[model samples]
Target: MVMIDMRDIQLDEDESEDQYEKLLRRAKTEDLTEISGIGCLYQCGVDRLGRPVIVFIGKWFPATKINLEKALLYVIHLMDPIVNGDYVIVYFHTLTSNNNYPSFTWLREVYNILPYKYKKHLKHFYVVHPTFWTKMMTWWFTTFMAPAIKEKVHNFPGIEYLYPDIPPQQLEIPAYITEYDMTINGIRYFEPDQSQNLLS
Candidate 1:
């Protein structure tokens, strides 16, 4: 029989989650403002599917790829205590387009270099509001991913479609996503005359 460390497991799941959350709330980066753009928000609860959800905004990424990677890694490290079991990463790339999007090469490199433990528990990857170029880029880049990884990807053209899978309140849907969704549905407060203003 194999030996196991009972101390490694926390009996009180809520207490463990609370501890992880405290760390995340206290987590600081070199650039505080940038944290809003690329940092993880709340982690107290799971998604609608009962899996831990890590929410990240794609457009908030720094222009420098290295900085972006570092910020993300730092955030993940802070949440390391709770990022086990079946976790689902809900990425809001609604505002990300070719102009601001990272190079496909960098994306491919990140995927190839992801740690095994990180890859194992990733149950789902939900990409919301994918642009035309985003779709094209994903199609091309996914060619390099294994079938299992590829199956985890799910694209959302509209937030309405995403609600069934992930509740709005559960994910704490960002204002920008809600705004974008409103614009998509011909509901916008600004420039009322231009009813069809959609963010790219």
Candidate 2:
């Protein structure tokens, strides 16, 4: 677990600011948004198809309930202004081949409680560089999604493959994802004959 130091949190210097402002400033300073691989939504710009781009990190987020809830609320708050009744938000989700992954139950809860207006704006969902494990997890999750949402989901083998659908310039690819070396951990897929070779 990561330890947070109260002393590290910065408070606003202006005494005239209201209590809400001070509290909000503290929240921003103390939140887990800085964690690597935590789910974050940033508006990059419009894609070639004119859909607004919203980037999301899928792994490395804190698994604890309190942290997860705070992250979800933060994402929704940032996304609200960018989405409108007619706007379509293009979600670009970065998937890690190995390492951390967000909890399924937590993700389900986050999606289930989203306002219809927010959900309706999600027109496309792209999973970047899906690995064998990601494919299996995605398949399991799809069973719970509405048909409309399912239809919007697609997978890209690599960054080059995403160019045709979502212009490469609009995306803010993380350095870790860009420099991913699949060869080191590439052969982890399930093979009945080589079941013992699976990654633990």
Candidate 3:
């Protein structure tokens, strides 16, 4: 039998508590006006299965202009309450230019720092209008680093595919995403009147 250092364990526990407190402070105090204005992340509503639906609009995120640390804090603030139960993420990748994408290192760091509780209750991760790069990057990351969530990740070429799992009526989808979907897929996911209204 080996001897365990109680002092070391206590120090680690204290460090974790301190870190959590710091994150809570930052989440409460950080100025996330720009991020909020762009509407990069929000809870649209609940899915058919009664899971909370968290939407992340990729095109709205200005990675270069925004402070990533504050953005991460804002994410924690928005998600902390929702993650306690089962939820699903709908990532709209429509019209996402290269500049909108965050750095791989930053993405990795955010993933690493996120508490396991956040990862545990995520039932599904839907990527709508996924590009080639998005698919490849997700494949690489999930396969190499996060194998547990690999099966939970689903890629959709258009919003129509997502409608089966999450009805269009349930989500407050951005108009631009629907327009882009129509442009590429040559089809509308919403009803005729709804599609017309979205375009109007």
Candidate 4:
């Protein structure tokens, strides 16, 4: 089932400002943009497309009842392209390391709002939804959902899954799923409602 243990995962060493610039530069695109919920929109300097970018990380934006809904609507609005069969890259960052913070359920809600084609076109549902705080559910996803999703992506986009930063924090892991790995970058900070657009 292609299992990867969280305990075995290790984030790459910290990157310097120059290296960070290189990574960002490499990620730039005249046809693509990345939205992040990790911080303010100012950090996102590129807006080659119509809108800057719509990053949907639960941690970066305010999750208050009103704010969360606003964010969701904003996400839904921006996701229209994905809804229309256009390629849209959604890079999500969970606010908390635990399974609780910024629920993936919300993502499902976002999914439900999508038109059936887009919803059906979703080839992969890569996530870090593992058991407790250990695995990335790679095996569980493959054994159970992957096959179904594989067939679905034929009409739907093929599913591409990710466990990005597993065992989000420092923690030991079970042996069977011991291939989990992640590369941490930048100083972890918490700031809410302070981010805005940067492409203006």
What total of clashing residue pairs does each candidate reach? 0, 0, 0, 23
Tens-place lDDT digits, model 2, residues 1-200: 99976555433313323433443354455554553234445667666667777776544443442356556556655665665643333333444323345677777765655545555777667776676676676777876664446666676655554555556688775676665524333533322333321111
What candidate 2 gets wrong by more than 4 Å, as runs, is 1-39, 64-66, 85-99, 181-200
Cα-based lDDT for every prediction: 0.60, 0.55, 0.81, 0.32
Which TM-score value belongs to model 2? 0.62
> Model 2, poorest ten-residue lDDT window?
191-200
List the candidates' TM-scores in order.
0.65, 0.62, 0.83, 0.34
Best by lDDT: 3
Candidate 2 local lDDT, residue 29:
59
Name the candidate, 1 or 3, with the larger lDDT value: 3
Model 3: lDDT equals: 0.81
lDDT of 4 by residue, 136-156 (tens): 333443345444343322110
> Ten residues in a row with the worst lDDT in model 3?
191-200
Write candidate 3's Cα lDDT for 1-200 as tens digits. Answer: 99999999788767766676688788878777766777889998787688888999998889988888878888988898888898999999888898898888998777766767777998888898888899999999999877768988988887877665676788898898888888987866444333322110
Clashing pairs in 2: none
Using lDDT as the yardstick, the better of models 1 and 4 is: 1
C-alpha RMSD by candidate, in order = 10.7, 14.1, 6.4, 19.9
